[model samples]
Target: MNRSAEMADLSGTIEVARVVLVIGLVFLHYFAYPNSRVPPFEGFDPNHHQVATFVNSFVLFFFFSAVPLLSTISGWLFFGFSARPWEAIRRRIGKRGWSLFVPLVIWNLGALAIAFALRAVAPTSSLLGPFGIDFAHFGLWDGVDAVLGLTRLPVAFQFWFVRDLFVTVLASPLLWLMLRHAPLLAAAALCVAWLADFTFFGLFIRTDVLFFFYLGALARLRGVEPRVGWNTTKLLLLVYVVLMALRALAPLAFDPSQPDQREMLDLFTRLARPLGVVACWGLCLRLAATAWGEVIGRYGGFAFFLHAAHFPLIIFVKFVLWRLVPAETDAWMIAHYAAS
Candidate 1:
């Protein structure tokens, strides 16, 4: 194939991978509702409940890589196409402001407005939490906190990715320059930052965004591409199995509340996510050589729309379920999972 055709094939493969990743994210969000802890499913048969818990844990273990993979792909595309760094950064910021920032603000406002309406209509419903616009309790500072993602009241919790993406894109030019000039040092600095945040502050700084974004830029600079053959694919599959095992055993190995344990898990996650991304990318690249891959690529852009709109739909479904079934009940949980 010609150079243009090759690039087009790569783009299509990435898009197909993105679509699959987003679907996995939807499933992750669905199953991870209430909390990351697997529910006991009380009153059910012990064997069946144990099986369900194990399945849930297994699924969530691998699903953790989706966001990192998305971030890396975004970085790759952003830097790969840019001829002039500053001009590209300026263009990207403007585009993302309209496409990302504006949507985030609108969504947050819309969610708050809907919550207020719900509270007004059904005063007894347990829907509204800190999101309710009670001037007496919720002040301007609280609104600021909500907008900044310190509080998940006004904004959909899923939009944290949007916020992080905006920040990463805004800083992409500088990161790109650093990677070009002193790649190793830049990577080391990012790793230190990530470690500090994960160890000390519990990831309040969101260095995962920076780490994966820069990793993508570095991959582009190094001309990295997926070249998985049968043997390599089998090796990667083994790596994936080992990663899943570690993820499943995490809770049993250490208390999540411990800083050291949290740090260890975070480090393990950093390793596992990129490995998963590579494995998924290789598979997508192989698929992209087929006819159906083109069809999948055509619909891949819908993933962004799905990400933006699914949270509201989830909330609506949960509200309907809440009205029908008691909270914390097995029926309500099942309905929420299905709706998601």
Candidate 2:
């Protein structure tokens, strides 16, 4: 096929894959992520009530789907990662982005300022009064915290992704060199490291994550336009499904009676996550090469932002609506109205 035809085909397939992924993600969050949609502990042990859990899951299925759609549009309008200050800084600083002195100085000041501000206005609110004014407690301050943590410092939950991204970016130079000399070996190393990451290391061991992105870049650099047939796509999809199944089963492999087996299963699941991510990503890329690729790519690009921002927006809207409206009506309805 000619270059334009190839590009269009890839774009279409990517779009379709992205749509499927978004749907699947919402499904997982609603049914799989219990803590997210379910009510917080009404009592001490936080026991899940059968009725509440059932209602929460039913409502969340629709709610999670809407967030991704909204977040995808927002990120596309805002300039992808252009909202990230450190991403800009990295472009300017290049490899020296990791140099501790100047970057650390800047980050510390930012954190301190946030801490002070959180403390200052915190007393008015029950939540913040005890924590003292800090980025950890404040809504506006958390985004800044995410940015600063992207500089490879650990600040909080969102910072983990940022830090992982940074670690990947910083190691790109060495990865580039390795790719030139030994592409096969480089890919193998990445797979192993990815497995290691699941079982042993924290997210900061970014070499594995960077490996796949670099692999994609290298394929482009090498003029490789993979023409994956339907059979191949099917095979990949099957493998992905099995991997996901195994991941779910991994935790259950151990009987509650067998702690040793449980630990092993837990370890296995950890390695399986990155592997599953790769398998899923591969299926996504293959599907993206088809007609619906463009749509998928657009939505997939905003997955991170939408994933993070939507929770807060959903929470805030739910809270406000609950206060204003009677409990007799649906909380999800109010959340939906506010979200819209």
Q: Give the candidate number with the greatest TM-score.
A: 1
Least accurate stretch of 10 residues (summed lDDT) in model 1? 39-48
Per-residue alpha-carbon lDDT of candidate 2 for residues 32-57, written as tens digits (9 for 90 to 100): 22123332111111233333343433
Compose the digit string of candidate 1's lDDT tens values, residues 1-340: 8889888777888889878788777666554445224432111122333333444555566767788778888777777664677787788778978887787777776765676577779766645543445534767776665565654433565677877777677777778679879998988888787655542243233666678778887888788864566567667867896777656656655555577776777677666766787777677777777898888888888988777666656656655655555565445555556654
| Alpha-carbon shift of residue 255 in model 2 (angstroms) | 6.0
Q: Estimate each model's TM-score.
A: 0.81, 0.52
The models' CA-based lDDT, in order, is 0.67, 0.43
By lDDT, the best candidate is 1
* 204 Cα displacement, candidate 2 (Å): 2.6
lDDT of 1: 0.67
Error of 2 at 163 (Å): 3.9
